[model samples]
Target: MQTPRPKTRRTFIKNAALGLTAASVLPRTFAKESPQPDMSLSYQDLPQWRGFNFLDFFVPNPAHARVKTPEEHFKWMRDWGFDFVRIPMAYPYFLDIDYSKDITPEEVYKFSEEKIAHVDRIVEAANKYGLHVSLNLHRAPGYCINAGFQEPYNLWKDQDALDAFCHHWELWAKRYKGISPDLISFDLLNEPSLREDMNDQHGKREAVPAETYHRVAKAAVDRIRSIAPNHLIVADGNSGGHVAVPELADLKIGQSCRGYWPFNISHHKAPWVYKDPTGLPPPKWPDGPEANREALIKFYQPWFDLKESGVGVHCGECGCYKETPHDVFLSWFGDVLSVLAERGIGFGLWEMTGDFGFLNSGRSDVDYEDWYGYKLDRKLLNLLQSV
Candidate 1:
């Protein structure tokens, strides 16, 4: 992945910009009552399961297939208070295929046993550590938000794509059939947004029409239950996990929400979201140029209502990039966590050990803790543990 290139930025200009930038912060209770992030949530309305995401298949290719997480991380997670781990996958990464050319639909169904054994190892090891594992397909059969390859069909509009989507889930349902639901769950897709095409990394993505989304989600859910009746399943919210999909509420599955509200802050200088974050005002806590806690409260009301309506809710992904000021990021994230916790919701940080993770975050201002060879962000870790 390309390193984020956030330009040297200033806070909203001092004099002229001061008056317009101030916004009320959430109550101090927001941070004091921190919520834990988890993916074992929103499924079967289980207790909030706390943990972090591991991005082995996030942007995999033939050369870097199956970058498994260190087993010690699972041991450490168990040592810590967290009880969950979400592993986002790229479907192609586990398949037997020739990467030199576009993959045929026939090849999509093919799996490589050696590559799949690594997944078995991960799930079994995490379970042994007593962490509930949520395996999600960040890159699916025919669509991906940060897509890298071209697919022959469109997931939202084509039967073939939906077939392959359900087939992959069916494969998992069989592999881990009869496992206790408390130990494992399958998040249907990373974030479902209707795109004009399958391969454009930067393309306009509107919500999949409610009917279309229901059809796709139900189809996948049906297939999973057919083989493994007790497999827990969670579907992401429509339009990049920001809005709840009423069409799916009847499906009796958990739904996910994102923590990147007031995008200017959570994704501060993220290149995939911002082509250039140069000269943009650095985000400020409580109220930045784009939003405040009031906005955040209003933004998640729909999700809260959905949870009230009996759909399990979880923040599948949340965290600031290394670019945001550490203090500012912490204050805002504290509110985000607290608010979700108040609603009995769970969350998952974007990752465990990368730019957005607990170790080697590359944040220049952090006071590092030398935990073995890892540059541990004890402040962030403490904040997460505070909830």
Candidate 2:
């Protein structure tokens, strides 16, 4: 085994910009108050699952392979009143393979016992902490939104990729068969591509249609349902969770969206995004050059429509980078959380302690302390707690 290297800030940013790429509940009391349609999944549907993504040792790195999130951490989260955790995992890390060699059905489909046990520990911790866990494949078989990483086959077009993808999920479904859906949920893929890159011989940039994405997603959903019919399936919206796929409305699964709207504010100084916010007007709360209440709501219309149709909605990933001002973060977060709460949507902050995180994110401006075995970002932590 190789020494696992800690994931760097750049890598974290890439995942954040992407996984930051990708809710619920209520009813009954409204009968006397008014005829309010439950626009989101009930607390019972998701158990008010709300917290952060724990990526201390996600995937793709060999260094952190033996790492395990301390069970105490989950207990701390529960003590803090958080009941949800989204764990973004990478499939490649758990497979026994030589990247130098051509991937075969045997290699891609096989699981490493060590990695499998690591994930099992995570699930056990979540159950003990009473947290609802959303297991996500940050880097799936053929689709990884992070640029520069290439897959030999296109997940949407290649049969092998699709088969391997579904098989990987089937294994998970089989492994955690008895785990109740109320405790563990499956997040099919991290930010799926906006459009499938069509490398035509003419050197043109053609793209696949949106409906095609639905087909790809449904295939995975169908496979998982075949074995784990009761497991809750959560599918992320396309294009970094910026848009919703209406085709998935009838799929009977939860919908996920992001909170990095009006990127200038949420992703200020983010190296991954193309637009330069160097001279862009500073973002303000309720009214800014970028991201205001109306703008945020407008961007969420499609997702809102999905919720109105009685589908579950969750903001799987959402937050501003550490460079973002504290006040600005609070303002943006306040509005975002308010809207989510109003719509009865459940959300998980981008992360817990790095990059787009509340603690130990390397923000020089904020005061911090070693609390509960982690650097605590008091201001940000307070803001999140208030919500």
The lDDT for every candidate, in the order shown, is 0.78, 0.69
Q: Residue-wise lDDT of candidate 2 within 103-149, one digit each (tens)? A: 54445555565656667777777778788888898877777666433
Query: Can you give the TM-score per candidate against the true fold?
Result: 0.87, 0.80
Most accurate candidate by TM-score:
1
Tens-place lDDT per residue, model 1, 1-387, is: 999766432221222222321221111111122132333333547567778998776664647653568889999988978988898888888776888788877667667656666677788778888888898989888888875787867889877788779877877766665456677888999888988865776786688899988999999999988875666788998887788886797888888889987788888888877888898798898875446677778889998888887878888898889999999999998888888888888888998787888788999999999987999999999888877
Q: Compared to the true structure, candidate 2 yields what TM-score?
A: 0.80
Error of 1 at 208 (Å): 0.4
Q: What local lDDT does model 2 show for residue 64?
A: 43
Question: Top lDDT: which candidate number?
Answer: 1
**Alpha-carbon runs more than 4 Å astray in model 2:** 1-47, 64-67, 99-106, 195-208, 274-283, 286-290
- Identify the runs in model 1 with alpha carbons over 4 angstroms from their true place: 1-44, 60-62, 288-290
